[model samples]
Target chain A: MKDWEKNIRIVEPYVPGEQPNFPEMIKLNTNENPYPPSPRVQKAKEELSIDILRLYPDPTSNLLVEELANYYGRKKEQVFVGVGSDDVLSVAFLTFLNSKKPILFPDITYSFYSVWADLYRIPYERPAVDENFQINKEDYYKENGGIIFANPNAPTSISVDLEFIEDILEHNQDVIVIVDEAYIDFGGISANSLIDRYENLLVVQTFSKSRSMAGMRIGFAMGNERLIKAMNDVKYSINSYTMNQPSLYLGVEAIKDEDYFRENINKIIFTRENTKNSLEKLGFDVLDSKTNFLFISHSQYKAEDIFAELRENKIFVRHFNLPRISNYLRVTVGTDAEMECFIRSIEEFLLKRA
Target chain B: MKDWEKNIRIVEPYVPGEQPNFPEMIKLNTNENPYPPSPRVQKAKEELSIDILRLYPDPTSNLLVEELANYYGRKKEQVFVGVGSDDVLSVAFLTFLNSKKPILFPDITYSFYSVWADLYRIPYERPAVDENFQINKEDYYKENGGIIFANPNAPTSISVDLEFIEDILEHNQDVIVIVDEAYIDFGGISANSLIDRYENLLVVQTFSKSRSMAGMRIGFAMGNERLIKAMNDVKYSINSYTMNQPSLYLGVEAIKDEDYFRENINKIIFTRENTKNSLEKLGFDVLDSKTNFLFISHSQYKAEDIFAELRENKIFVRHFNLPRISNYLRVTVGTDAEMECFIRSIEEFLLKRA
Candidate 1:
């Protein structure tokens, strides 16, 4: 109503999962890693100097890119560093989508996709997934501005295979297909391997899950040099020093400590197995989860009622209030002890409802 | 060039100020705090556990806003935080400027202003500063969308009075006027005082200067509730978690340590005075500095020539190849030993030239 002209305010802003740091609550709302980032992260912190805080971070994030390239068996130009995975994805929308072509993404995946598309004033379409919630590769052969989806898709842990993604890229040469591998370290094979073969494919991954550096806010993408270069062009126009100096050192250190990454992810997978079995035995319909979280609902009790009941017992779980997912509660897997407490609390809540 | 979009190619991006971390050859090129940040920044670093790194940063940045509001005596809604001043400025352009209104700034101020204006396709008029590089307040009374400039303007350290700023705001009721106080703590009064009276004034400041947390990347803006709310809407639609966690804690700690801030600013002012005196005695025309830097040049030596000569002797000072500023070198006031070395090196270079 005032004189200022912002973008078409059609975007329903992405609300992050609640972070209730309540005293002595068994919390599992967001899919944060159950363990610390590598012990190397602490070493990096110890070596950080007040004096070094005067210098800007390397814009290229050269050292982290070097490490990531080695891990993926690709050149440094194939990788682009951003403040977070969400930051990387936003840049991808601008780099890949244009007014000439419409963006294509899953109808039931990350809500942030629509928000970004709207913000850029780019037209977008949502191609539906199969009944099993898996990406149908055949539906994406037409001309598109870009295609993006979360692997082991959010609120529905259905992952698309790297082989299928490559097949899509093979048929659709003109459009960029972004394979978001945010939860890839848990189970799904990353399209990072196919990045050398497919110029149109960009694999976006995060340290938030496997390396456990979410609060530090660093994310990276791997693609062919041309695609990565295009993203860089957009990024340079925005905040150039996106990653601050302390986070730069921490990110490099996190990547270097592969043993810690493996150990922590293995622990989460093991815990997910245990939690999944317990939920199924409790007469809950839990989908097979390859992520650090599970999508599930009870047949008798409504998901909303169960969520409210769990909160009464000082336990938290994520329930999206949308037409597609209002009946399900997506529960993040925490530490072994935290999971056990969460399971017990849920059992009590559901049993009382029954 | 390949398929779509425009003006992205052939963009001569503005190079950020030098980071220069390799043993820093007298390190006066960029305007970083010569001294380290508050010791409490280190304390905050120590207090961080790697376990917390797995979680997302609070998107609202509520705690940092509270501390900033308390520091500035403004309501929480009157404050806004960003990754750095650059992030704040970028959002300002996106939020305030439209296709219909003209953005205005000084022609000879921060070079990034034009870069951003071009990036957003926001039409802007750079009202020329006076001959002595002073900001004439009368020049800004024109009808405009938003007015922004670094107070104690960059390159040349001339400050405009806050009284003049209040007058402009009172007259221009519907428009937004941004006062960038990037260097205010060193000398000039912040337009923060005028925020209560002028609903239109948005004063942007950063921790990069007096707080000494540049590498940590935190900045803030103080304005009326409505103006800040519009800016926040833009920020949230953009990057939600604008500040990284450790940087947020570091900025909070740095601001709370007023004694440390005061001491370092005093030392910087002392060094600036001494450097200006030495430059004047050496037959150089030094601008009266209110910042931790000096704008100086000799009548005999071309600024570009001296810049090259100093680099050969492993010293660095910044010289812009822009209009009306080609003859002067912007030298950051460094440590006493660093300044002595710079003087000796410059004298040697001059003697060799003669």
Candidate 2:
């Protein structure tokens, strides 16, 4: 190795789900929304003049923030925007979690939490979830630098109620608590209602799952003005122009069509319930999912085997090889026809094994 | 103040140039391209399918990286892309400047350099540029953590030759040296030619200025495979999906039309020379600019006064309130008609002062 290479900051990066582009594949990984974005998005794209590409986008993203503020019934100063939910959460970690004490989160939650902690050299500890993959609110009552966890958590698809969140917030009032709501719009209740009550709580959401504009890369956080202002300060010191022009313009249109947004969310919920029933009938123990995905395990087969079989048949699902959850497969709720095809493939695999 | 607020990381953010939206404003404050993007960019936008917005953009941004590699005659592994040059440079600072020693740059260069060092807590020393605003290469020969400077540097619009850069690289072989070439397309020679010879050198450029895609937010870096890989690892850990789908697809079309790129660049250079001659005739001293903007000062009027007068006439130019350069103004070269209007406005202002 070269002498200069000694100073390079290196880390094991988080591996995102595979994005294969097979023409006929049924992709149920990454928790992407099955339906397209609202029709107003198409109109917004059409109205965008090509000539506007010469100027810089509004550094503050005021238009999108105002629309989001209006839609969520919050003050404009309460909203902050980023490239995606990951970006928003990452910036929040840097800006708020600065104490010497170790921060805390559930061990079986979104994996990116630890990655961000490690990247920033912020000491952290993982408080393991209980046996049912539920976040124990009492686990966070201890002193720490900060706290963060995903509600309707990734890979588990289980959500805690508003009362459960308020219980934890009641105990941890001295530190900032981040509730990542990437899956909230599917079925989970948002902590946005409590933003007015708790100045230390920051609730984050994204356009990837429910709004169906992940390709445009938009996410935001809602909190009290002071917390939002601090995050904006760090963000501007890093990169003032995070959201591009098309995203700012089209994201407003995505929020304007409230009926279309509701229609798509309802469709995904309906499909998720039906898929859970089919998998349960097939002898799989499916978790009670409030998000648009199902986590299931079979009594007689390994999750790695099922995941491999599904991929061989051109179907995709997520499986973590970590301890205690190696037997589980997290499948995103796709279109009804896509889920039907996935069920058929699973049946064939189980029959052949028998 | 709240107890939890003590942990929030706060800093004074970098203030970007004004992006005023008046109907008839002559906007020469930010150095954006005066022409629209390539015609092919319009075709690409028209051909894009809105349905693709439902999924996440390719996290690696492979399509744009490959196109940049092909255009620059480098391997794909030697290239990196980000939301814009600011994002790319910010990540580079985090990845490469990790040692205990202080990094080096010019005091009067791009103001964001110091802001980034402060944000990341990296120790840095700014060897002041000489009275002529030229970097003294010998100042960089000492020990340092890393080095970075803008060639055809910001606000001064001056560039050092290729041999001068080669000399600095020879002296700083023990640490990473970054050549920020944001204004290289206007006139300066790029250090990209020296990448094959120096493995420790990283060159960053942006599409916002010359390709007319500031609204789309595209920027990239070229270096040896090792340096590029280190930057990518840090970027992936931060935000895997930095570049959006529309930017990746349309950026390729921007590179394919070399004729339009060169035509616009030549026009800007032509307008810059004529504007310089006109300003000199008005008894204003203009620096020899090798960028899309000109650095100038008037013996009879303060820069703040000129900036205020221009704003009153709806012609915006940039004035920085700092030591040594407080009397200088940075005016971006605009279209022929726009520059004529600007010249007339300045002439009238001078007559009034006389």
Candidate 3:
């Protein structure tokens, strides 16, 4: 206990959801898309000649950057790619959130925001999400080092309008504002279109949810040239080869297949609405969810009991043990059939408890 | 033009070697394996079902960890894998190199060492390598936060024996010592066998050089369980899913093929010896190389000139403009035929100079 481990880093690390390999398990945790990647991604994998892996990937991820820039109608200098949205946000935190003042975010947003602020020793303030799980725009107007939040906030499954986001950006002219739009493709309006007007805005999106490439780990940020340059400096300093050859190749293919991407997005949105109606019928208070997941809590049935019961029935959903959200369950909208089974499981659990 | 970008990260980032996508070029700039990956890696790629792209990769890289643990005869707790060795070293810098004192490494070791130290604001000192391109064990015995050096160091292509490495580890009981063995399989002895003896020692290796998976971006560190735990904490704090699914699946396949690995390593070693001899016959002062590359300088010809001439002939070699190694050319040992072509091209350039 008294060895050289004293100076080493020690933190209560962020725990990811369980990735059980059982075949019969219904996994609704971690907010992954229930659809496979495009046929082009499969084609890319099929045509991949293994000989090319002997060399290193392009350090700048130029091709992927070009594709992302073209997709968003931004210049190549405005796009920066990373291993995932986590990587993009982590690097962004290090690059833009370094002022002496404390940065600001919603308390009930992505749990990783505070973890990242702590890891980088960047001072931060998490103003509380209101009782209805909405971020009050005035709280972000105060002085801060920088500002970052998921567009459709995690766990709460709520989306803030772009006009309010622009108000925050307009107030905080001297600081960077990162809009982590990880779930923006799932019916939420993107802050990317505001990049030209707001030089400090960085809109990060991931292929994990919308394009069904969570296993590939590709995400990117679109912002002003100067901000993207700062991010690149930090990224190249950290790891030049953040994205691998296969991920880069498949990412391009995935981006090109717009029809397949939209089809899955529509399916997820449709199921989310149906799931919301079904949960309401089951006496659950479902939040207004714009994401691929729905946050719900039943007044009679404790979320802890339901989570346990669902696990026993081989149905898994995320239940946070954190304060103020312990009673709520963030359920990823799976296939229509999976949601039906999930609803049935919840009904059985409630009946047994009654 | 003045904005919030002033306090942001402004590092003079490390520039990696060129990755020109030319079909006719013999690329010997970066130290890539001349041979392809194992046939099993190809099989893994071919048999990979695209359906799994819907789910996130195992955050802990459990199966790949198991394969690497089994291969190195270490426990799973002792192995920490990352996107690349740069990511591993960067995380290790954050984890173990947190003391008040400055960490120590050779002045001309891996260039990324200084970049990482600067990126994280970790204090570091670079002691000069001896005239024979060797690391003196006594230089690292001083008071420091940590120690790291590439075995068979990059661009210099010289290696220090394990006893010297052990001597530094033995002397520095209170600090972490990282022996980056990126090129160890090219005849240099690995300090991995000494992991059981020294709890303070951390051995970092990569699939880039030895296993021919540079495009896949896989690397790992083997050390004490306590240190690995600390690293995992920092890694989890930074980004949980660093390695992608394809990298994880194929990395396991690459590790299971020991014969394919050994055969390619032997081939690179053989070509290295032959290349060194050939360079010497052309009046170049070749450093005794233990890696897949040969570091040579010619008294009659400047390295910059040769680098340009080689590029004109569709041959690329690394030429550093840094202080100590300004006149040197770090030539990656390519296939026998590529080396022959390289030799003939060098001869033609010298003949033209005459």
- Per DockQ, the best of the predicted structures is 3
**Better DockQ candidate (2, 3):** 3
Query: Can you write out model 2's per-residue Cα lDDT over A278-310, one digit (the tens) per residue?
Result: 999999999999898999999999999999999
| Residue-by-residue lDDT tens digits, candidate 3, B80-104 | 9999898998999988888889999
Ranking by lDDT: 2, 3, 1
Per-model root-mean-square deviation over C-alphas: 2.1, 0.8, 1.1
Q: Alpha carbon lDDT of residue A278, candidate 1? A: 95
Number of backbone collisions per candidate: 0, 0, 0
Scored by lDDT, model 2 comes in at 0.93
Q: Which model is ahead, 2 or 3, in terms of TM-score? A: 2
Residue-wise C-alpha lDDT for candidate 1, range A57-139, written one tens digit per residue: 67777888898889878899988988888888888876676645777888888777887887767788888987767778877
Error of 2 at A151 (Å): 0.7
Q: How many backbone clashes does candidate 2 have?
A: 0
Full-model lDDT for every candidate: 0.81, 0.93, 0.91
- TM-score for chain A as predicted in candidate 1: 0.96
Question: Can you give the lDDT of residue B149 in candidate 3?
Answer: 89
Q: Output the worst ten-in-a-row residue range by lDDT, candidate 1 chain B.
A: B2-11
Model 3, A221-281: lDDT tens digits are 9999999988998999999998999998999999999999889899999999999999999
Candidate order by decreasing TM-score: 2, 3, 1
**Candidate 2, B1-354: lDDT as tens digits:** 788898898787677667899999999999998899999999999888889998899988889899999999999999999989999999999999999999999999988899899989999999999999989999999999999999989989999999999999999998999999999999999999999999999999999998999999889999999999999888889888888889988999999999999999999999999999999999889999999999999999999998899989999999999999999999999999999999999999998988
